[model samples]
Target: MKALFIGGTGTISSAITKQLVEQGCELYLLNRGNRNAALPTGVNLIQADINDEAHVAELIENLAFDVVADFIAFEPAQLERDYRLFKDKTKQFMFISSASAYQTPLSDYRITEGTPLSNPYWQYSRNKIACEDYLMKQYREHGFPITIVRPSHTYDERSIPLGVHGGRGSWQVARRMLANKPVIIHGDGTSLWTMTHNSDFAKGFIGLMGNIHAIGESVHITSDESVTWNQIYEIIADALGVKLNAVHVSSEFLAACSKVDYRGGLLGDKANSVVFDNAKLKRLVPEFVATTRLDQGIKQTVAYILAHPEHQTEDKEFDAWCDKVIQALDAAARSITE
Candidate 1:
């Protein structure tokens, strides 16, 4: 099969790109070519800005693909542009959505593809929900061969995944761990969460590509393994060989206090306990199994980040904010005791 990936060199798409190439698929990556250095062998690079529709059309003139996956289309406008661009050019069009688009303050803790999509807390998720709606509408009216994929907290080797952190990156959380400073774990740290490795995600994703059964379907690919927020923090700490100083704070309080995007990160998504039902994905891809356990994945990710000095980015402002939040919470507890 011939496949084309838009914005392929990202944390999640990068693994999908490599996996397709290894599976003997002729793959072409459409991006700005900035991260072309890390692309796997047997992959072709199509250098052009996707926003430049005229130029992109001219570049791929009359070229068709068996599958075209868009990893960067977040909003309806982008998906509209994609629909126009690839309407007649590909056999299958995959739009990468987010698991956060699922109903917030969920009616049920167990999530399936049948779960109704609704989120009011985060505009980002709302936009993604809109994008999915548009794509599904297109698929219904025009048979657009649409396959919607929603990914949860999927991580690669570049950075460690954390429940709460600054905008810069997740490195600051690890820096706090190394310094024995308190790191925030939103809520009582008992809320269940699933963290899937990028490589593991690729397995289920690749199975859906050019799949006949997957057409006109909405599927979220996530690990069957679920761990508590406390366990996630402890895994990271264990990977770093350090004792975690966990500071538990209410999700509402953190959202109110944070100047960052914590509102969406917490109230919109991470704040809720989610146990994804990959039964749909398993029914489609019988061999799909996420083997990378949380502890094993975190250990490798930590080792990679530590071996590379460039990954240790410290944010003084975020560090100060963490301290301030901790102090305020402590002061409130003391007042109650008095």
Candidate 2:
């Protein structure tokens, strides 16, 4: 089958493209060519701003595709534009949505696909929900062939272990503990965290794509296991075999720090702790499961960080804060497990 992938250069999208190629499908990529993505040798490349409806329409007017995977469409307008442009040409449209679309104020547990969407507070989640609504409307009204895949936090070997806001990873916590630095934790560090390996998520995406019965359905791509923030830090601390000097700060304080317009804090404590349900995805792709556990994922990430010494940071303040957080997390984890 012929397929076109938008935002084909991103971490997750790149993996999806690679898997599709391996399946012997004719692949075409559509992106601005900003990221130096290595496409398969025979894949076709189409460079166009998706926002430019006229340009996109003109380019793909005569083209026909079996599937179009939209990895970067967050705006409803973009969805409408693309749907209008490719509705007739493409037989199926797949939108890559985020599990963050789920509404906050969650209970202390994982959330399934049936959970309600997050309140329209953040633009990112709001826009994603808007696009999903649009897709659903089109599907019901015009019989548009669309499938939605919501992916939770995903990591891989190439994943840069930074927080969602581009800070350090858990490995950095281990390094700080080993070096006798402080670790910082926003709030109580009790929030549950779950991450999926990129490879596993990609495999799920491919599975859904080939399954004709998946059309007009929304599925999540994630791991079945869940871990708390504190648990994650303790795992890293154990791996490093070092005592942690961790500190717990109020989420309100971190939110204020993030708003101080400083370099180290762009995010607030309110953003911590989100859980997702991957049962639907697991049921769909029974053979595809996350091979990397939390500890294994952390070890791989730590090893990568250590091997790439050039990527190290010498920020003593951040390092100390990380160490403090890690220590507190270790204590909390021990208490919970006990």
Candidate 3:
């Protein structure tokens, strides 16, 4: 099959791209030349900015694809642009949506595709909901072949996955752990969350590429393995060969005090416990299953970051904020005792 990926060099997409190439499918990647090194030897490269419609049109004027997946589209306008660009040029179009688009303060802890789509706290999730709405409309009105895949907290070896992280990246959290500094856990640290490795996510995603039954369906591909926030931090600390100094803090307080918009990441999504039902994904892709446990996945990721100096990014501002929050909370506890 001839497949084209709009943003194939990302953590998730990169894994899918590798699997596609290994499967001997004809693959083409559309992106700037920055991530060319990540592509395998057999894949074709279309080095152009996707925003440059004229350039993209000229390049793909006569080309048709069996499947086209867009990993970079976040807004409704971008999805509209994708619809206009590839409406008639592809047999199947996949939109990478977020599982966070599901209703927040969830009425149901066990999430299925049937879970109502709503999230008021995060504009990011709202935008994804809008994009999904647009695509579903297109599918219903125009019989557009579109498949929606929602991934929850998927990570790769390039970075460790964490619920509470600095604006810069996850490196700072790892840095703090290594330095014996206390790292914050958003809630009591017992809230259930699922983390899927990119390789594991790729298995479910690639199976849906040309899948006929998946065209009109919305499915979220995640690991069935649910771990608590405390366990999540513990896994990361264990990987770093350091003891965790966890400071428990309220998610609401963290959101209020954060300089960046933590409302979306904290209150809207990760703060709530979520366990995904991948039965629909399994039914569609009979071979799909997530096998990577958090401990094993996190260990690989931590090793990668520590080995690569370039990945050790620092965020002093966020570090200072964490320290400030910890100190004030401690002082408050002391005052209460007095």
Candidate 4:
């Protein structure tokens, strides 16, 4: 198999890159050469800014691929660019969409490919929905060989996953846990969520490459295991060898208090419980199974982040903001009693 991946060295794509190489797939990664150091031996690198379309066009004009995937494209316009570039060049085109594109305040908690696509709280999810719509239109009208993939709450060793965190990253929340500071969990921390290990995500994704039956289909690859936000936080705390100092906060209040996109990241997505049914993915990729449990994956992540200083970035602003939120809520309680 021959494949071209744009933005290959991300948290999700990195694992796929390694797995594809191990499976004897000829892989080419087109990205700025900033983060490609750990890539496997058989991988080819096309170091260029994908935004530089004219240059990229000149670079890959002579190349044809079995599959071309875009991990960086989020907007409909960006996907339109992909369509123009790879219309006849690749046999298969994959667009990485988001499961958050599913209806917010969901009519049903059980999610499948048949679930309606609608998310008004987050523009990010809306953009993904628009991209999916555009690709499906192309697939139906023009017979474009497109496979839309939705990955929900996928994580790797590079970063810890969390429900409520700042723009900086999830490291700050992990840092708070290490320090025994009260970490925020949106909406009483009981809302169910799914987290897919990127390595496990790779197994399902690799199965779809060059898959004829997957053409013109949209499938979400996620773990069947679902846990509440409280369990998630508790797992992280246990991984770090610390007692969970959890502060339950309303999603609405957090949306109002913070500049972060809590309205979308919380209320639109994480605040609501969601359990993914990977039946479609299993039918397409028979061997697909998510072996990484929450405790297992998070323990590896916690160990890696602690050992590497580069991953432990401190966000004093977010830390102070968390403190402020906790304090204001405490004062309101005192006032109500007095």
Candidate 5:
């Protein structure tokens, strides 16, 4: 199968990219070629900004693909650009949408593809919803042949997945854990969340590509394993060989105090308990099963980060922010006691 992936080297798409190559599928990645991910031989790379439609069009003028999946499109306008370029060049055009597009605070803690898309707390999610709507409309009206795949909190070996982290990445939180510094966990850390290892996500996703059943449908690929936020942190700490010094804070208070948009990330998405029902995905991709448990995945991630010093990027600003938030909470406790 000839598949074209735009922005293939990411936490979610990278694993899929590697898998396609391993299967000996004719895969082409169209991106700026800036990421450090090693591409297996026999894979083609088209280096260009996907935003530059005219230039990208010229580059792939006569090329036709069985699948053209864009992993970087966030907003609808970007999808509009994608629609313009790959309209007829590919048989199946896949859009990587976010699972966070589901209704915030959720009427039901369980999520299926049928779950209504409405996220007021986050414009990012709302934009993803718009993207899906536009693509689905094209599929219905003009036969754009779009397939949407939403992934919930998919992680790779490069970075640890944590509920609370700074703009830089989750490495800072892991560093704090290693140093025995108090690591802030959003909410009480008991809110259930799902994390899918990228390889596991890749299996579900690859099963959908080129399959006629997946066209005009939106499916989320995630592990069925749902663990509490506290459990998540504790697992990471265990992997790092450190006793967790967890400081739990309310998502609301964290949002109010921090400059980062915790309201969207936490309130809109993570803070609330969420359990993904992968029934539809199972029906579509019968072989798909998330084998890597949270403990196993977190341990591998922590190990990868530890071995690769480059991934251990320090975010001094976010670290300072964390310190400030922790100090304020402590002071508030003291004031209440006094």
Candidate 6:
């Protein structure tokens, strides 16, 4: 089987590519050629930006692929372009979406795929829901073979502290606790979070691809276990052996800062709370299991942070905030347990 992957260098895409290669499927990676990553030996790399539909179409025009895994599709225009470009040549098109697409309010802790999508005007969630709707529409209208995978908080070795695929925000809190810094909690830090390891998510994606029955369906890829923010901070503090000193910031403050016209502020707005349900995914991939526990994932993240002291120094304010929150959380947990 021949498969083409978009955004090959990204953490999730990289894991998918590795697994596809190991499965003996001929692989092709398409990207803008800016990121430097080690590709599996003999895999074809095509340098083209999907934003330029004409160029992307021209590059993949002659190639017939059994599967096209789109990891970086965020805009409806891009999804439309890809469908028009490869609808005939590709047997199946898989889109990588986020669990945030669920339309239910953030307070709704357990969200399933059936939930209504958020408003289309909300940038990040809107874009994903739009893309998913476009794909499903195409599938119904033209019998376009497609699969949608919604992943929640994927983390792995390639994960950076604050970048895409960053482990849960709790990692930053843990780092702050270790350094005897003050951590800031947005709201009460009572929200529940569940995360899937990249490797496990990749396995689920591959499993879906191999199963023909999985076509024309959306699946949630998430961890079996869930942890609350308070629990998460306490776990990190225990791991790092630090005292808790944290400030509880009102959610209004976070909301106000997020309203600022800046990328960082916008990101903060979108990341305050996210929760999902993976029951359908679990039912679909019965054999799939997450190997990395939250404790282990946190330990790995802490080790990486300590080894890369430069990162901490570079983001001193952020680091200090993380420390304070973790410490405060730990102290709070101890009080409750006592």
RMSD of each: 0.9, 5.7, 0.8, 0.8, 1.0, 5.6
- Lowest summed lDDT window (length 10), candidate 4: 182-191
Q: Over the stretch 159-214, how does candidate 3's per-residue lDDT look in tens digits?
A: 88988888899899998999999999998999999999999999999989899989
- The TM-score of predicted model 5 comes to 0.98
Go through the candidates in order and give each one's C-alpha lDDT.
Answer: 0.93, 0.71, 0.93, 0.93, 0.91, 0.69
Give residue 26's lDDT in candidate 2 (0 to 100): 90
Q: In candidate 1, which residue pairs get closer than 3 Å at backbone N, Cα or C atoms, i.e. clash? A: none
Root-mean-square deviation of Cα positions for candidate 1 versus the true structure, in angstroms: 0.9
What digit string (tens of lDDT, one per residue) describes model 4 on residues 174-269?
A: 889888889999888878999999999999999999999999999999999999999999999999999999999999999998899899888888
lDDT of 2 by residue, 1-338 (tens): 89888888776887777777788889888878887446766678888887787898788877899889899888988898888888898888999887777765554446788887864445677788889999999999999999999887777654434331214434454555687766665556676667777777888888887567777889988777778766766776765666655566665545444422222221321345666666777677777777778788867766776677755554545555444445665787899999
List model 6 lDDT by residue over 1-338, tens digit each. 88888887776877777888888888888888787357777678898877788898888878998888888889999898888888998889999987767653544656787776674324776788889989999999999999998886776653322221122333454555566766564456666667666777888888787567778999888777777656666656665767666555554444344322223222333344565666777677878877878878766766676676544434445554444445655787799999
TM-scores, in order shown? Answer: 0.98, 0.81, 0.98, 0.99, 0.98, 0.81
Q: Clashes per prediction?
A: 0, 19, 0, 0, 1, 10
Instruction: Please list the residue runs of candidate 4 whose C-alpha ends up more than 4 Å from where it truly belongs after superposition.
Output: none
Stretches of candidate 6 above 4 Å error? 106-108, 119-121, 158-175, 258-275, 308-313, 316-338
Candidate 1 worst ten-residue window by lDDT: 254-263
Predicted candidate 4, C-alpha RMSD: 0.8
In model 1, the number of clashes is 0
Off by over 4 Å in 2: 160-179, 237-243, 260-275, 309-338
**Residue-by-residue lDDT tens digits, candidate 5, 1-338:** 99999989889888998899999999999999898358777779999999888999999998999999999998989999998898989999999999999988799999999889999999999999999999999999999998899999999999998888888988988889889999999988888999999999999999999999999999999999989998999999999999999999999998898888999999999998889999999999999999999899989988888889989899999999999999988998999999
Task: For model 5, state the Cα shift of residue 265 in Å.
Answer: 0.8
lDDT of 5 at 226: 88
